[model samples]
Target chain A: MKIALDAMGGDFAPQAAVAGAVLAAQQLAGKAQVVLIGTEEAVRPLLQEYGPAAATLELVPSTQVIEMGEHPAKAFQQKPDSSIAVGYRLLHSGTVEAFCSAGNTGAMLVGAMFTVKAVPGVLRPAIANFVPKLDGGMGIMLDVGANADCKPEMLEQFGELGSLYAQYVLGIARPKVGLMSLGEEEGKGSAVTQAAHQLLKVNPHVHFIGNLEGRDLFNDKADVIVCDGFTGNVILKMAESMYDIMVTRQLDDEFFARVNYETIGGSPILGINDNAIIGHGVSTPRAICNMLMQGYQMAYAGIVDQIKDSFKS
Target chain B: MKIALDAMGGDFAPQAAVAGAVLAAQQLAGKAQVVLIGTEEAVRPLLQEYGPAAATLELVPSTQVIEMGEHPAKAFQQKPDSSIAVGYRLLHSGTVEAFCSAGNTGAMLVGAMFTVKAVPGVLRPAIANFVPKLDGGMGIMLDVGANADCKPEMLEQFGELGSLYAQYVLGIARPKVGLMSLGEEEGKGSAVTQAAHQLLKVNPHVHFIGNLEGRDLFNDKADVIVCDGFTGNVILKMAESMYDIMVTRQLDDEFFARVNYETIGGSPILGINDNAIIGHGVSTPRAICNMLMQGYQMAYAGIVDQIKDSFKS
Candidate 1:
């Protein structure tokens, strides 16, 4: 099996990307091969520096790059030879099991929709981020930024997508899904959440745990928390900010250390037809390695197939 | 000026409320008076126990109490003499300059709406909570739990209301009002926030700043952050939970210590005809005392009158 990374992605690309690919290759030695897709000129020299360590890593040449500031849809269309575009092409043609990027988030999302595409029955694919629970376990929150304005049906679908990922990837048994709202009471939320709550409660697909307030994100209340992308995005950024604040204050704690973006690697674009992960723009080598490792795990677990199966029935 | 408290409100009421009233009374000795409203039997003894410390505090008998779990609108209508109801009556009749309760949150909101009522031309009232900025200063967030669903005009009004509070009560000059969104770009956010952004950009009542992400909450980006009630409430509860986590871990940090609910005491219901604050349900004496002090400050600043004037124009 081969897992791919966009070597020209992220701020410190080529160097960080190449270094990370080497690290993942070492860890996945007997398990899988790691592929790097980028301009040969930028990546060849870096691979030479690693010499034997970079020997296990495969290089796929792409002449163009997708600058982060360019329009996602426009750039993805114009730069067919871009690393991101090529990575998607490889994944689509069964050349790689998974594709990962620390590049333009919007572009990565656009590629996921246009290339791998949404699973047959999925209304929309959601970006799922990991939340480090207080008890040292992990939970997943979905629709992090995919569909900012989500319908009740969309939120209900997110619950199912997150639940499938939690069960198949995270290995949480009978994962409890919670709808994010202001109050825990069934009647206490915006019109959309209130409607979503009703749909989730009766759905046979999940162990719906009713409403969850924002405070429940890090608790043992549920393994999957679902919400509109706007709410989830705000929360994802806020939690990240809090972690940044803790670091700036030099207040080190085990749980907070887990909150760092690097540890989790990247947010997976769930409900897509195949495995694809989006990393932070400032990802370090360690972060990139973790992201690649996560990509391998997703591909090995075949979470995409599980999602397709779940949505089919 | 007279500031009234619902002695029978909150979980630790009577004792906590009486003790807090004494603290506030002492602090406002020459400037204002503190009035406690509760069943005489429940409050008189607690006050007597304080001896001379409670001498300056005045008691107003309320025959009924609004339990935390009671239906807000129904209970307010059925129990006209409830401490929360009595407090509002006093505020409405000009017997007290401000009214505060840590009781049934819904009942408190009901009383505010049914009694003192919304200010003329105010679309709806909002609950404003204080956010502890990373800097030593404080900023206020509004519509924390009221009006879970809000219109674009309502959001624009919230920005105006929060700006007034920041300027008059919090004493921040030309307070920057920020509309919370998924991104900092003007074009980002939900349909409502997108439309609201346009309204706020040209509204002369505020110094409308561009969009703010969740990560900007603690930064010096905006003095006033306007969002829908659902988003605001989630953020408030999430912040409170983070504070709780810090406390449980016993990580002593001055900045996080300021995030404690006791420091701010209560959330003020803005755009109402009179000054009204709703304290935390688990209010300790310290929290209650701070709430009363906040009430005194609001009354002194004449913020309600300011809101009325702004909306009137």
Candidate 2:
């Protein structure tokens, strides 16, 4: 399977993107292909050091580049040949099994919507991440800002997506899902949270664990946490900030030395047709490597296929 | 100053509650007068252990205890002489300068509102807690489930209360007040967060630091973080869950050693007319000691006076 790479994306542009892709392909051997997309001239120099491995790295020519600040929809329309747009187009047109980019998220989401389209029955395609928990397991939180203002129905869909992700990707059977709320009691949240709580209670597919308040996240009460994009995003971002702060403040030399970015890799973009994953913008080489490995693992896990089947069934 | 303690509150009612008060009075020395409000028989045995220090402790007669499942308003009304009710009455009738409880949060909030009353200009009092950043510093997020459904104007007041708390309690001069939202952009967040963001920007007394998302909590970008109780509570609880999970997973030894509740003490009731601090139900001896110390400091800080001044000025 080939992974469409957005060579013109991210702060480091073609250099970091191309270098990471070459390293990924080398590590994966001939089992996978890296189809680089962007201006040939810009990507060629970075490909030079790969030697024989460089031959396996394919390039798709594109003329335009989407500036980071460009309006998402406008940039996609105006720069259809941009690396990000072209990468998604390749996946949309079935040129590759998956697509990867460290591009503007708004543009990426917009592209995903206009190009690949949302999974059928899924109201919103959520961006989720794994948060390490006390039980030596990680919890999956969905709608972590994919759709900021979600309807009651949208939250219900997020529960399914979060549940399915944990079951397939995280390997949690009958993953317990919790609706994020202010209080644990029934009818104890805003209209949105309260209504969502009621829906989850009656929904048979979800292993609804009643209402979980803010402090309950750290507890092993639920395996898959669900909320509207706005609240979920806030929770995700806050947790990320706290983790970063803790690592910076407490973790010492060896903790991140061998396993930094270029090592652990990226987060899988769930609900997409392909295996596109996103990394932290500030991802190091080690983290990028890990992301590549993560992408490989996800593909092997058939997360996308599982999601497709779940959506269908 | 005397503090009315509700001994019949919390899951460990009258047992841990009585013990915590006895411990608090001993720890406070002669600095505070303690009034343990509960059935005299239930508290007397626990008070027996303190003996001399227990001399500073007195029993205020109360028969009924508000059960967690009982309706807060209805229960409080029916049991006017309940522990929580008596505690509030002591605070209101000027017999006690403050009241503290580890009871049902709904009951506490209701008791606070109808008993001690809201500070003069305060629209609503919020449940405020310190989020311990991995950095030695902390962030204060308010309205954490106090007023789940809030309007734009109430959020502005929350910002003010948060700022005042940071200034006097935390000692950050001209505390950078943040309005929590989906993102930091001026136009970001839901309708209420956005509107609150605009109002905070112009409020003279508040050092409005623009919008902050969840990830910003640990960045030290803002000294005082403000959001409606619903969102703030979700963020706080999620961050808390992350902290609990990370520490337990990575620092097992430290987790056990620092396993006591003193790591983060109880939350304080802000925007009230009296000095009231509500602790976590899972309070340990160390946690109770720390909470009592905090209650003392809050009294010393004249937080109630400052809140009153906010209204008068």
Candidate 3:
């Protein structure tokens, strides 16, 4: 299967992206084809630095690169020939089996959603990030800023999606799903969270584990933590900030730094029809490599298909 | 100045609270008096453990104690003579200079607000927690759950109150204030947070450091991290969960047995008319003592007066 890569994405675009592609190609040993999408002028030089893998890798030339700070939806529209837009189009047209990017997150989400569209019966695309907890198990946080406002039904769907993703991808059977709320009790949180909590608790498919307050999230009590995009994004940012602060304090600097940069290989964007993954824009070769592998595993598992099946009931 | 202590509050009640009061009295050296409020039968034995320091501490009898799982608002109505309710009333009636408890958080906040009332011009009372950061300085997060839906004006007020508390208590001048949002950009969060961002940017009295996402709360990027109670509580609980998860794994024992307990200190309830501090219910002797001392400092610093002045503008 051929995977489309956004070569011109992120602060260290082309160079880091291309290097990561080469590394992944080497690791996969051509079992999977890497198709780099970007302008040849910018990418060829970076590709040449790789020496051998550069020649073996395929290049699909695109003219523009979306800047990180640019308005995401508008940028994708204006820069139709940009790597993200082009790569997404390839995925849409079925030329590529999956797509990955370390570009503007907003742009990537917009490109993936508008171009590829959501799977049938799915409410909206959700971005799930792996948060490293001390339990040796990661907490899957969903809708980590895909859509800000979510209905109760949408939240239930997110819980189901998160549960399935955890079970199939993270290898947790009957993964316990908890709705993020203010308190773990029956009548905790705002109207939205409360309603969602009730829905998830009663849903037969999801291993609904009642409401989990922010404090309960890190416990091994729940494998999948579901919240609206706004709260999820806030939680994600909080975890990221803590890691940064802890590392900056020089507390086991290398350990936390590796945990911060290396452990979280990538955040898979679930709910879409195709295999679309978005890695940290500040992707090191290692993080990108992890994302590539994660994408491969996710594609093989047919998580999207499982998600579709989840909605069937 | 005299302080009323709810000895019957918290899981370790009477014992830890009595010990803390005795320690506080010794530390203060007759500067502040301690008035323990609880059932005489339950408190007398615990006070005996303090030896001579118990002589300086007096007891005011109360028949009931609010349980951890009890409904806070109704508990006061059902048992007005409950130690927490009575202690707050003592503070309200000017019979005591301050009241300290390690009781039901909701009950504490309710008693304090319904009895002592908010300092003049304060829209709402907020629960502020000091997050120990790598910078050696603590980041104070306010409105951790007191008021979920806050207006831009209220957030500005929260920022000012948080800043004032940080300045007087923590001794930071022009304390940096950050509005918590989904992202750090100028227009990145929900309407409330985004608008609060704009207002904070223009507010001159505040150090207004602009928008801070949840991740930045743990970092020393700012001294005061402000958010509505709903979001703030979520972040607080999430961080708390992180601490719990880490401690449990590090100790590898039963959850409660694994907790350091020593670090589970009290959270100061800001914006009340009087110096009233609330500790976590499961607090240890050290945390309760620290909070008692904190209550003394807050009372002596004329924190309410300073808060009164900051909001006058």
Model 2 agreement with the true structure over B43-86: per-residue lDDT tens digits: 88878976876778889989888887889889989988888888
Per-residue lDDT over A1-313 for candidate 3, one digit per residue giving the tens place of the 0 to 100 score: 7777888876788788888888888876656778889998998888778788666678999999899999999999999999999999898887877788889999999987899888888888799887655456777889888877788999998898888888898888889888887777878787788888888878888989888788865568888888888888888776776666545544443323434744676777888888888888789777777787777778777788898887774
- The DockQ scores of all candidates, in the order shown, are 0.89, 0.57, 0.53
TM-score of every candidate relative to the true structure? 0.99, 0.89, 0.92
Q: List, in the given order, the native-contact fraction of each candidate.
A: 0.83, 0.91, 0.76
**Residue-by-residue lDDT tens digits, candidate 1, B1-313:** 9999999999998888888898888889999989999998999989899999998889999999989999999999999999998999999999999998999999999999998899999999999998999889999998899999999999999999999999999999999999999988898899999999999999998999989999999999999999999999999999999989988988889998888999999999999999999999999999999999999999999999899999995
Better of 1 and 2 by lDDT: 1
lDDT of 1 by residue, A145-234 (tens): 988898999999999999999998999989999999999999999999999999999999999999999899999999999999999999
Tell me the docking grade of candidate 1. Answer: high
True contacts kept of 3: 0.76
Once fitted onto the true fold, the runs of candidate 2 whose alpha carbons sit more than 4 angstroms away are A133-138, A167-173, A215-220, A250-275, A290-313, B12-15, B26-30, B133-138, B246-264
Candidates 2 and 3 compared by TM-score, better number: 3
**Tens digit of lDDT per residue, candidate 2, span A173-220?**
999999888778887888887888888889877899988887766568
Among all candidates shown, the one with the greatest DockQ: 1
lDDT (CA) for every model shown?
A: 0.94, 0.76, 0.80
Whole-model lDDT, candidate 1?
0.94
User: Model 3, which residues run further than 4 Å from truth?
Assistant: A53-56, A133-135, A248-261, B245-264, B309-313
Considering only N, C-alpha and C atoms within 3 Å, which residue pairs clash in candidate 1?
none
DockQ of structure 2: 0.57
